[model samples]
Target: MNSPRLAPPTTWFRMGLHRYLGWEQAVTLAANRLSGFRPVRAVFATASRLGDGIGWYAILLGLAWHDGLVAFQPVGWMLGTALVGLLLYGAIKKLTARPRPCAVCDGIRLSVHPLDKYSFPSGHTLHAVNFSLQLTAYAPELAWLVVPFALLVAASRMVLGLHYLSDVLAGALLGGLLAMLALLAQ
Candidate 1:
């Protein structure tokens, strides 16, 4: 009889190895509970609720609907970067049907209202990374704030046990690549 070939380790296993080291429960709890903080909750809530509609509106208003030298130029760049990154993220999500961590893991409880879809690469992390990268490219001085904020967004997904580390890593890479392409195209 031929031996069976084991499947490669899932992205969850590689990125979520920390869970086996005793911090899984603690980190999940922190990620889930931190949302209770008003400011933190507000930030996440706003991002989550806006979806892609806001991005669309910004792009339209800034690029197609506006006509100004100083103001429209920056808006055009910002909207262009955000739109390209978001479109790429959506495409990847559609292509990879990986299940969300919560769907596969019984070890942790997820947020009550978590997104309903695959979790190979987190959309939230991608958005944050892309936005930060674009901002950094435009105004290098804001690196201190943008970098930390991007890190926080990635950490929040991990803490919430909503994504594997690999998901965030892939998302960061995707965002950076898309942002670079967008900038280059401009």
Candidate 2:
């Protein structure tokens, strides 16, 4: 017969997989390299911790406390966005089941111990962007600090090799959208 034989589904899948993984690995390795210096490692590690931990909340709480209960409306807005955004992040992570960059990229910084296994969408960056959005809407003056801090948090995820650029950027965009929705609700 003159008909051509098509490759099996598994073979096609493997080829596609390798192409994406190879690209992801190369990008991850390059970003991980930025963490070679001790100061960068220290900054990124701390940024990751602060991003993922209660540090963000501490800042929110402090702001709310300083401004009184009525001024705490911004905190409510941020928390609501965080809740929705994080839920979306969790769903994407579960569906993708992507591994952390550190797991794929050897010679990683091994900064702070990650709380979860998969790293499709970064919760830290999600929170950072959501909070920053609310801050921008409520307090433009703080946006100068908040915006940079959010960007740093997003970058920290890559520097620590915990996430890819796609993960953080997706988180940031989704987070901003969620915050906007929360604002409408408010």
Taken over the whole model, the C-alpha lDDT of each candidate is 0.65, 0.81
Best model number under TM-score: 2
Worst 10 residues of 1 by lDDT: 51-60
Task: Judge candidate 2 at residue 106 and give its lDDT.
Answer: 69
In the range 11-80, model 2's lDDT, one tens digit per residue, is 9999998898788777777777888888988887877777874767887887887788876777877876
All predictions: root-mean-square deviation over Cα? 6.4, 3.0
C-alpha TM-score for every candidate: 0.63, 0.84
Error of 1 at 3 (Å): 18
lDDT tens digits by residue: candidate 1, 1-186: 999986577966865675653454454555656666667766655544443245324533543444455445555666676667677777787899777666776665564356658777877787777767776776577678667767766776765557766678888898788778767876
**Taking the candidates one at a time, how many backbone clashes does each contain?**
0, 0
Residue pairs with backbone atoms closer than 3 Å in model 2 (clashes):
none
